[model samples]
Target: MADTRERDIIHAFVELSNELVDGYDIVDLLSGWTTNCAQLLDVAAAGLLLADGRDVLHVVAASSERTHDLEVFQLQRHQGPCLDCFNTGVAVNVPNLEVEAHRWPDFVRIARSKGFASVHAVPMRLQGTTLGAFGLFGDTPGSLNEDDLALAQALIHVASVAIINERAASDRDVINAQLQHALTGRIVLEQAKGVLANEGNLEMQDAFAVLRRYARDHQRKLTVLADQVVNREVSGQEILRHARFTSIRP
Candidate 1:
């Protein structure tokens, strides 16, 4: 079992390293990172939260629907382990959510309601600046073993370096603008997905497929297309028209 987990961790490293290539999508890359973390770390769920230039943290990716909601709630209420990790630029290891009631009353309450018993949050840091945080949620109340904690920290360090290198390749203002744009676009995209799903009686994944397919076929940025949907510049039905037979990766 240990050997298998070791192999999985190595594979995850390779996959994350590959995301450093040109033309990689930051959102998709971070999303994949969370998925990989959940699978390899024996966690019930995982998530990534990035801080914008304004120092406000926003959810970037989530490994599962529940974790997604958890991260969203963190951003909404301005409290959670991930928030603490980012703000302090250090890891926050909570062996049990119940024990954190005094530290994060609302967050712990909601997390417990979601069936999460523990959490570990690692800061994504580069050159003294914390770009974000990686959160791991567990169903049982226990801390990550030292080896596992070290591995998680290493992975996050690599991710931070990759993100910083990518941003450094662009102009300062351009990177800031891009980060702000992605932040706003993600919120709009989430709303648009809900609108499309409800309107078309489709699953959220299917609604996202419709939106992604339309954007790819039309040579438009996914967020730009999402903005259009939110602004009523395009109809959800138009996206649904092409959802069938259109398979999107990431």
Candidate 2:
């Protein structure tokens, strides 16, 4: 009976595998995974967790309000099957929450209170780098069958690819912007240094020090003052003398 049910779930998981292309919506993709798993596998609920660029656990998508609550519940407790899978790079298959070493005491207490009798987590990772976990909760107490575990594991692999791909794309955008930002700041700083040196008859390095100090002291970005000086919009008397180089007050 379980085998037949698991096959249906596995087939849908395989069907969803084709949709894991780049640029696919992260929320929608994972939500679909949760929905399909629940319906086909007889699970109570499911969710996928992913680490953001800053490595914070974010519940990207959920199947239901209870699933949403459960994800938050896991994060808040910080000691659950999902965390184990994420940290250890191993799957956690707690078939019966009531009978065990209670590896996830906090998690089990809450899940049991909510009427869930079992839980499972599969890591979304390759070998070294784990991006997150694929979590499952069930109403009846008994470990997920071998077939169900296989299906979930397969689904987890596909989810990892999609997640890693998305994270890479997001990271690329950030890196490119940061490079552009740094390059622009350097150009402006260099231009400001020249203006300060020319006006003060001081060495280029000293001019930079003064600019740096003043910008830091004022808690303002150096680019703003640098732009003004470059455009001849401000004087350099204080700049030449290394006095507090203030911008032209309108």
Candidate 3:
């Protein structure tokens, strides 16, 4: 039975890991983390928090609104395992919330009211940098088994790596697209120069000079104007009408 459960959990793990998209939506990213945490870890519910660029953390996603409410309860009460784990970048595992006397008074009361008997918080972090912490609520008491704890920690690291990888891929795609645009512009400039000289009976050198001066005066890209000319969309007469070239003619 245990082996089958473990396999089921691992299958869910790989599936969610594969769902990771570069530059994923914020809600979808956090929701996936919370849902997977509950699925792969021995917990009844899950919650996720996020730190914005300003370093303030917020409850960004939760498996249920009830979980969101409990997280909000912790935030409002200002004391809980999640806060501790977030600040210290460590896991906080409360085996039983109902009967644990040495608990965060406010957290225990709220969690007991919500019918969650045990709670565990694992820091979602990367390389000593703490982003936030994930919360796991259980219906029974007793600390997680060694395997379960290890799996939770591993998932946190996976979440962090996925986020970083997604951001890097997004940046790379943007740069690659800009480089392609630049090369395309160069080609259009070449095509435009050919058209200008061939149509106006001007030397290639003088034709290029005329094109540059016109673009500069009009505050347009030479490549853009070149595209227009090559397509017969604009005439050299229209372009040179404003300039006096002592040694050049249209």
RMSD to native for every prediction? 3.7, 18.8, 21.6
Clashing pairs in 2: 95-143, 200-240
State the lDDT of candidate 1 residue by residue for 144-180, as single tens digits.
Answer: 9998888888878776665556546345555456566
Better of 1 and 2 by TM-score: 1
Query: What are the per-residue Cα lDDT tens digits for candidate 2 across 39-138?
Result: 7656888876766444556565555556656777889888788877888878888888887536767777777887888888888764356677778888
- Could you say which candidate leads in TM-score? 1
Candidate 3 lowest-lDDT run of ten: 21-30
Candidate lDDT values, in order? 0.79, 0.66, 0.69
Error of 1 at 38 (Å): 1.2
* Estimated TM-score for each candidate: 0.79, 0.58, 0.61
Q: Name every residue pair that clashes in candidate 3.
A: none
Clashing pairs in 1: none
Stretches of model 3 off by over 4 angstroms after superposition = 21-23, 99-103, 166-250
Ranking of models by lDDT: 1, 3, 2
Residue range 108-170, candidate 3, lDDT tens digits: 887888878888888876544566788888878878889988888777777666555534434
Ranking by TM-score: 1, 3, 2
